[model samples]
Target: MFPAEQTLQLRALDPEDNRIETSAGIFVVEGSAFDEGLEAVAIDSWGTSSCALDAYSAGDVADLGDGETFTLNADGTYIWQGDDDQISGRAQRFFFTATIPPDFTLSNYDQVLLDEKNSEGMAKAFFNTLTVVIPATIILILIAAFAAYALAWMKFPGRALLVATVVGLLVVPLQLALIPLLTFHVGAMELLTSVMGTVDEDSKLTSVNWFGNWFGMSEGEKIAGKGYFGAWLAHTGFGLPLAIYLLRHYMVGLPRDIIENASVDGATEFQIFTKIILPLSFPALASFAIFQFLWTWNDLLVALVFLIDSSGNTTVMTKQIVELLGTRGGDWEILATSAFVSIAVPLLVFFMMQKYLVRGLLAGSVK
Candidate 1:
């Protein structure tokens, strides 16, 4: 017996003998049938005041009995039976034949899963970018401010040439010197190791069991050979030329009268720069910072050249996004999400610094 929410159980008979048994209540059957074995049975309701049996057969079926009993001679059919003659319908069921193209397969589900994973990886990449951004910004601003003041106001031999040389370097594309620079970095690291009495026969920095403790490094972790420090140096080096050039121009453009007046009041160069020049050059410094922040934030080639293979330990956001795209191109959703995440930091930097960008630090320089 079967109710609306309950299922009916039925036993299968052999292919030749199709026997249907109906109890006193409604019965429902749902199952497939074999070619030489029992066929699928369908029983919606039976023996009720309003009962109907809709039978769907694949082939010509020999109804062995009336509403009470049904049989199939050859092919299989779905049969729905009802009592009290309230509803009765019979239909033939046919086997469906689908032709799949030779090249096509089910791939939508896999693509969706891959896209989700890529999106997560992209988020991690954004975090890495922040790690690079915050420290690099602070370092650049400090170094640039000091250098700018020295070149602009403080008199020294070769100061003009030094400023000109740094500006001239802006013409040299970074791609041209990438390899040479990396080689120099590697060699310098080795030299530092040798000077510190830590070089091994293979020229690698020897592990110092005690120094790690002093520096709070793990017992076996390599502290100085290559790592975050190396990356920071590379970023600072690449960022220095433009930073120095822009900042020098802005600082040099500060009011000469202000400096002369500060000097007349018995102010030292350090005091003048710290108290007068710095406060006045904030706009120029902020502008240069925005430029450097964006360039370094979106940098992929530099990261690849310097920090490749530093995946889990030191991989940046750019590298992470690139890897995700290469591995999961089919995942459009993930790609879009990753793209937006990567841009979010630069966007914030620009929006935050935009207010001060309009001021001209050179306003009172000439006068």
Candidate 2:
């Protein structure tokens, strides 16, 4: 468009002779302005079109339709004998088109699986999901293990009420707590920052922020309850009810004599939990681990509320896949590839932890 009125024309012939007409290239580099469609394939391997007039013998001419013929000079100038002005020495950007044969008539795995932006690959989201899930699962299991041991064996004030509350929470929907928990996370962070961090001239706290208008999006925007740690805590809270309940059931089934002997031998609660109870509860731990991992890995709503920020740095796989489907809805082959890629980890976890699945699910049924 540098010439304003004159236009660059382009066409392509695929390897299968599919003449492609919808293609153009915008040269942002110094080499050429006569290439949008031509180098899109070069930049990202998305072969939009193949120019029809690219082949020529050493001393022979290739006919460019419309009475045009191009020459490649020794200095690499594209000299053309056509009605339009020559583009051999321009430094400005312009659009160009050609009809060379395309390198591919059909795309392979490379095109669908790998790209510059990784639109279909979803790599960023995949690893972000792992970041959220693994630590969250660990924290859930550790806390639940101790609480389950206390609820099952030790007597304390309101212990029965705690058990009843946990059982009642099993039937409560997690969605109901989202807003309140988000508020609590923000309030706690604000309190911590007020105590531990100084206020600057800009009125921003110097502490690691949870939810504040750091981006200047608005005076009221929140950021605290939407990060990895927040996601970890959210998943942990949402998962704790089942984890504690299930673990308590399993721990209750453990031999009474073993725990009694450990106590009689002067074993502290912590010692008993680590040395005696943990080894005996491996199956239950893994069973809860499988549940927590699977839930956190596939979760979208909690991630959206608790993990994802405007920066998209903490996007999980489900959210990323939703984006892929929305943006590339036309590419069914790529969509299929993405589907397979997304489910791979969950499937592997299921198969690897299948043995513990039954034990965990049926923990308290018989007793």
Candidate 3:
């Protein structure tokens, strides 16, 4: 409901009589489509009000009681004095009070999902973000777990220095590497595709179609192009430092006797890591998985740099939301709907992994 201070006011009423009134505009009371209330409507001579009036009609003006006010019709038209009077002016700005009810409907989601022509739609971008996040999270977590386990348990020279270096990487700001990494990915991908193209026609590598298919190419094409692979590698590189640091600390605190006992029983290093340390470090792994998934899922800059190319077929949810801002600037319905859709995944992941997040935070903090 509009406050009394901001409510539309009838500043002036010309010829407040029954004579042949010229340019007479009468206001009417009408129910708003948005809410159940009496909305005040009036026209401003200065045209400073945001509302615009279309036409005027001729009818008896409604009487206003103590707290009552007049509202314009939905079309912003009302009847004035008589047939001779014609309301025509340059500064005829229409003003109206609007009350909105607290309600929600699934139509917005339906439109966002089903409207393919909507460049701002979340359907394709949502899946594209998933493609970037799922593989990136899984690959990075696996690689980081192995590195963290090695740092925690392996007896090697300069091990402490290596641990220090990994921990130090956590302090490095990711922004510094943005330009360099993008440059590297672009250059490296060109070289990689060139080499792939130069491969022999009858080579056994080409016989395996996995490499070609992964890059959105055919075996005959034999070229690795820009796609989810580059984005996955970029996220892995950025996420590895934190993943290793967190998992290493948690792995080091596990029962040392259990690992030693596994070794005494003639278990291989891989076995002990897979069968013992991996299970015990679930909290840390889940914590990092949530972090990396949410980060990669919500990333716009990295996706723009590595994943999305000139085609824009692989745009992620974040980038799609940004495009919405430009095209649908005034449409708050589409903007708000797209925003919530982008955030929905992160919210779901947080709620599901909250226990592990708390456990990871508390794990190495205590003695």
Candidate 4:
């Protein structure tokens, strides 16, 4: 349907049916569609020092060859990489129109794994899963390493009780702690904001809240005042039990003379732990890291409760896969391919570190 109001105009080109104009304005005269939409170039904004992205938004004129321009628009958010700093990102134009593809190949990968609106948004979700899994794995490992070293080598008050408690927690279901932990996480953030924040009334968040973007978890990034920080702590809490139990057993198995001789040389416990224990306990650390990484990577429950909001900015792969299954459940090809996309990373991770995994699993696995 050409514009009914405006007089139709066309170039002198012949066979106008397949020649959709790619330049200026989208125009369709009589029996053919010759139209132009928008064009956006994504020059990489990534700087050398950091992942400073050169982001661009697609122009609003985007539309399929529907003979109607400006009628289809969608939010196209794509996140590439994320560290404690800002995430690498890009935006695409998601235009929707009802039309058949010229041909159907293996496109389930596209349909199930892509799209800004209903598709799983696997690209962002993959990086988002990384954002949660990597940090959570690192945090839990470091904390557990310290706790394990102290428990194994140092004699402190309540040492036995602490070990017992960690062991006890290993049996506790993480489900039991989710609600309580989220409540506490939210409360603590609010308390901090109230105490040490410059409130920005327009956004209803402190202009500069805790850590103040030093770690890149600013107030604006929070959903219900919880985002990566909350998710990190949540994963850390659940993982600490197993992390400590495994590491402590492994640390205790370290040679007594090495630790005693290090202390005899007047080396501090911190030095011993860093220089001696860390190097020696690499396998145990790696094994726990693998387990922790896999747990957080595949976890939908913790991600939903602690990280993701209605905005879907912080969604992880597991949740995204669930959305795909829910929305495109009938499409078996899509479900199959989507399942592959979900496991690819974990499989790669497992294979890469599998040798250490075996050593971690067997080395003084229990006290």
Q: What do the candidate models score in CA lDDT, each in turn? A: 0.60, 0.65, 0.67, 0.66
Give the winner by TM-score: 1 or 2.
Answer: 2
**Residue 233 in model 4: lDDT:** 94
Candidate 1 wrong stretches, greater than 4 Å: 1-116, 195-220, 224-226, 326-333, 360-367
- Per-residue lDDT of model 3, residues 169-211, tens digit only: 9988888887788777767765665444344533313433454
Candidate 3 total steric clashes: 5
Provide the clashing-pair count of each candidate structure. 8, 18, 5, 3
Poorly placed runs, candidate 4 (over 4 Å): 1-105, 113-120, 198-223, 326-328, 365-367
**What would the per-residue lDDT of candidate 1 be over residues 79-157, giving only the tens digit for each residue?**
4433423112332222321122233333433442355865455555666667776777779888978987898888889
Which scores higher on lDDT, 3 or 4? 3
TM-score of 2: 0.63
Which structure is stronger by TM-score: 2 or 4?
4
Candidate numbers, best TM-score first, in rank order: 3, 4, 2, 1
In model 2, what is the error at residue 70, expressed in angstroms? 38
Distance (Å) between predicted and true CA of 2, model 2?
Answer: 47
Worst 10 residues of 2 by lDDT: 40-49
Error of 3 at 69 (Å): 30
Q: How well does each candidate superpose onto the true structure, as a TM-score? A: 0.61, 0.63, 0.66, 0.64
For model 4, how does the per-residue alpha-carbon lDDT over 1-367 read when each residue is reduced to its tens digit? 2211111112222323322433354332222122333222221221111121212223233222333322111222221211211111221222221222234456767676555564547788888888888889999999999999999999989999999999889889989999999999888876665444455643344566555555455565333556999999999998888889888988989999998999999999899999999999999999889888888887889888988999989988877767775542434445567778788888999999999999877787555
The lDDT, on a scale of 0 to 1, for candidate 4 is: 0.66
